[model samples]
Target: MFFTLSYRKTFIGSFDKIGDAIDKLKQHQESYSAISSPRFRKSRSGEIIRIDYGSSDCYYLIEKGERDDRTIN
Candidate 1:
């Protein structure tokens, strides 16, 4: 059996899976040795995941209830 694979460049689709992020994590820095601005999400989902920006290695929010609840989601 033989198989050939080719790749095409395109826009990144929606981030719906953890496995979809296979690209190498790149880091950005400023001349003043300062961290970049942090991103604010509306939900607790992906809250624990630290972004490549700022120096907040251990900063996040903790939701009080389940994420699947009607009011939460």
Candidate 2:
């Protein structure tokens, strides 16, 4: 699965699976300015799972890409 992970609108990486994606996000967990909870979303492109720290500061750790790799879609 081709994923577009980002932090502060900065491109992180393109993982192949949900597990890898989640792992990547966890690596940057402590970097968050605040702490609240996590969230998930399914869009027309792919799944977007993120964590909410506070304010508008959030990391879009998962964004399905259009690459024809090993993806759920």
Candidate 3:
């Protein structure tokens, strides 16, 4: 089986092992989180609220078949 790492629906990289994919995903998330900042929006009552973005859910690990485009026949 092959593993594909994706971020925000875009393909990042393909890996031969699941562990490698997971490690890459973790690294990406950490990097993104470190640079990401919270946004503030005003509600209907004119109260400002902070919206924090979590990088954990933005990354995905997908298992691909042997005949996938990234794999050799």
Q: Return the TM-score for each candidate structure.
A: 0.18, 0.47, 0.43
RMSD of each: 14.9, 6.8, 12.4
Candidate 2 has what TM-score?
Answer: 0.47
Identify the leading candidate in terms of lDDT. Answer: 2
What is the model-wide C-alpha lDDT for candidate 2?
0.51
lDDT of 3 at 20: 74
Question: Cα RMSD for candidate 2?
Answer: 6.8
Winning candidate number (TM-score):
2
| Clash number for each model | 0, 1, 0
By lDDT, the better pick of 2 and 3 is 2
Candidate 3 residue-wise lDDT, 1-73, digit = tens = 3333333334546777766755565566566555454232212222211122344343344444443454432
Candidate 1 vs candidate 3, lDDT winner: 3
* Model 3 stretches astray by more than 4 angstroms: 1-7, 34-59, 66-73
**What's the candidate order when arranged by decreasing lDDT?**
2, 3, 1
